[model samples]
Target: MVADAPMTPVDIEPLPRLARLAWDRAPALCASRDGCADYHRSWSMLRLVRAGGKPPAGWRFFHAEIARAAARGARRVLISGGADAGLLAIVASGFRNAGVVPRITFVDRCATPVMQNRLLGAELGLDLRAETADLREFRADGMDLVIAHSFLVFFETAERARVVANWAESLAPGGALLMSSALADEGPGALWRPASADDIPARKARLQAQARGAGLTPAEAAELADVAGRVWATRPSDRTGGLTEAELRGHFRAAGLAVERIACKPRADAPALGAARQRRRAEIVARAPG
Candidate 1:
């Protein structure tokens, strides 16, 4: 039998009650009226109640890297994307566990998640710097650690290089960028294949069931399901797709960061939204050369 990896000291705290409240209020707070609010609302609900509320795969590796940076007297952490405060909380907890308190900056285009992170920060008694800006255009310097989980998939193939370059520029020498991406067999320029019309009912039903299980009222669950269907039906044709392993690595190296470590593994328990295709999850640690 393969031996399990030794456990690291980083512990992922449970999603705070305020974070849940932020998610619960997301629909109203979301500025995107074109089904974007519904998109976030449904996904946030499912994520909150997903089996065991488990952190994403390879979280231990992320924790270890964050702890190491903290031990090295690193500060000025940045989170490149935000759908919720979950990533912020994880990074903060990692630094605290490592016996260092780092200043954290969170950037996201959407105001709702920025507010959410602010609320979460207050709840955790941590001062969080939250910004509303697109990652491709946002810039900072002297960052010791930057993290973005499942963030790259949202950008088109042509836009990814710029985003990676921005990430590299934001880091100080010897600073690290820790990120994860969903991988696919398809190459660049491949857009996510939208769900077929026939599949919408089944997908909505599943989401509704999951929402109810997550404590949404029956009516609220139905609304969430309806909104999800609308969003999927109208999903943009240019919605960027997953990156192939090669594309992911190339983007990092092209941005002038040294690829320190990368691990990709199949996610057996991924939700059914894209279950028809084989998708792997990648956890990467890249560093800016001193």
Candidate 2:
């Protein structure tokens, strides 16, 4: 049996009352029209991060493997966060281009993704199902590939361990999990609330300036700002965090997964996001025993 992993250092301050309430009510809250709008806006913002017409950096990191699997007729995939329906759609599009049709299952607790997937999946002609269910209560078996981006960060360590264990068990022998998120050597959970009024605007302005500096036209910058605003609507109540490489490796081992490949990219704005002295964004691929 794999030993328990060492816990990474985390700031254990209580979440704000409002944040706590929002977390508790997220499922219901996100079932509304407004929730759909929030997700639509977030995906638009995500496009800027990926520089349009390209897969997000994280997805690009593992696309080759996914395509190879599809080529081999291993076309069953589960994208764990329906909020990531956009990613699922993109993957499906890639498969279509290669003349391979894949079966996809997109799961999330929020209704927004479920609604979005129906529309998007139909438009893309992908065989898929979007499920809205609490991760703890969700179950599946024999998936060939699982993609979960920005999903694990929502849970605390013990809960994350449970969730990963479940996903690992759900994997078909030799199935793999591809995930990406930010990680820190030392810090509170990766979720960041604004530190102060001054800090918030300063960070926003810096991001805008960076966009402009990247040669984005004024109109493009304005469009990105609008998308960013919608995404920022939940920043005050965000509940996301990450683990160090060592911590992540330990977690994988404990969950009965073998680390297959891993990569990290230093974020230029890590400090602005309230990360500790050393934080890096990470992508990992792990596999179950065949």
Candidate 3:
């Protein structure tokens, strides 16, 4: 039994436009040799949208923090390395939920997500700037809040430090950096692999169910499941080994950011997704010195 309740149409209404954009564009992108096509194909807009544009855990805390930042006069926000509009929507909802509006800058290396975000921004009447840029080389100063979701794992171990340093430099004095990372034991290799062979089938089934629940036809859901399974089995995931809590804190400290909070917990949906190992999810909040 899928533990989550059935979603009402209103719950998913905001997603179809973006989903249409992704679905229409993914095939051409795949044919054009875009490296992220596998990801886009596997986690279709249906899947992403059905996931409710929120992290599996600690989302309340994140939402609260965003509201608090806005209350404290945070107006300039940066969303780093999101591959789609999901995180942008989540952040925008956070501000609106608190009756605040902040100017947002969203950066990703992929043009597709940039375009999607631009569409979302227009729909929301938000002051959003969408750009395609590598986060490692991207530079902007005086941002009041910098946010990313499950982002660090996408970078190799060596690149993680540089990314954090860049985020630090992008912040205004006393600005905050809020992010989440999956934590695991450090290993020599950086490649991300399925936790176990069972992980593939379990994840595929979940995706198929989510796709169906999001209103895809049975055949469409099955196709998505097939693509997701094949991609998971054959493709090298664009992710590196997870970071340890100590390593995460060290990086923030080395970047001269004071660690305000590091809340670690097992992901609520991890077991359902067939994560065999006990991977801890960490929500990090850090601040630059005044």
Candidate 4:
């Protein structure tokens, strides 16, 4: 059941006003909600490659662990940054099929995925709700589990820590948070960086080469270039990037959550440039102390 009182004080700070504004304008700026599906499919393909053409070990563990939580009586599950609804759908379906009823909530601002999630919930007959809410201001106590995958990278470093604290505080004591992401060993760079004067030609050349190598027709390549350019146009300057496993654990611990488990491997599918961005990625499960 949802708790009557909030576990923590309301988060007074908001992400940079620009960050919120950009996100609010994303639908219009990008003019492509279907890209969300493509994004979900790309991640699935990445997992296959990382597993040597099989499902990644981490994903297997992810499913098994959620089922275990459900079996242990976890009923209120929240998936933060569930904008795509792809992972949320899988989680809800798994619990429903396993006969473990859960009250699943999707916290995302985008309307497209929110609509997608509702349709999915109706089809699966799972108890699910999509809330177009800002996670920074989100509050609920007695949450059994929270999932945040590929989420923290959207904010600046300090913002990431604060958000983590909010999530940890929202959980009932001993409740768990599941997170997975590729991490950089050094500075947490922008998730999407703008091209500088020197960067313009270099980025253009790279995109052209990539498109040609992928066998995209001329029109498709031009379209991809247009999309790529627009992405940079909307990028937040202080966007968060990656963190080492130890570094991520430190964030949880600092927030009063204990590091429960960590699984890591080099990015098996990363290209040369991608490898420079991050050497490896990790899947982590951390819990609030009971």
**lDDT digits (tens) for residues 1-290 of candidate 2:** 21143111111111122222322334454756444544543453444343433344565555566666666667788888745345675566555544666788888776655655665677557688887777766768889888887666667777778788888987899898888766656654444323552354554565566557656667655555565555665542134445567767777899899998888777654455333445566888899998
Note the Cα lDDT for every prediction shown.
Answer: 0.72, 0.62, 0.73, 0.60
Give the CA lDDT, 0 to 100, for residue 157 in model 4. Answer: 70
User: Per-residue lDDT tens digits of candidate 4, residues 174-267?
Assistant: 8999887665555554332223523645665566556656555676456555555544344332344455565677778799999888876765
lDDT of 3 by residue, 101-153 (tens): 78999998777777788888887799999988889889788999999877887
Least well predicted 10-residue stretch by lDDT in candidate 2: 6-15
Q: What is the lDDT of residue 30 in candidate 4?
A: 29
Ranking by TM-score: 1, 3, 2, 4
Question: In lDDT terms, how accurate is model 2?
Answer: 0.62
Any runs in candidate 4 off by more than 4 Å, and if so which? 1-58, 186-225, 232-238, 269-277
Best lDDT goes to which candidate? 3
In model 4, the worst 10-residue window by lDDT is 6-15
**C-alpha displacement of 207 in model 1, angstroms?**
3.2
Q: Write one digit per residue (lDDT tens) for candidate 1, span 1-290.
A: 21144333224334535345655777677776433576556554555654435554556677778868877888889999867766776777677667666789999887777877787787677768898887888888899988988888777876888888999999999999998766775533343344444498988898788878878789977877787787767643236655677787899889899998778776555445544555677788899998
Residue pairs with backbone overlap in model 1? none
- Candidate 3: where are CA atoms >4 Å away? 1-13, 29-34, 44-57, 185-214, 234-239, 268-277
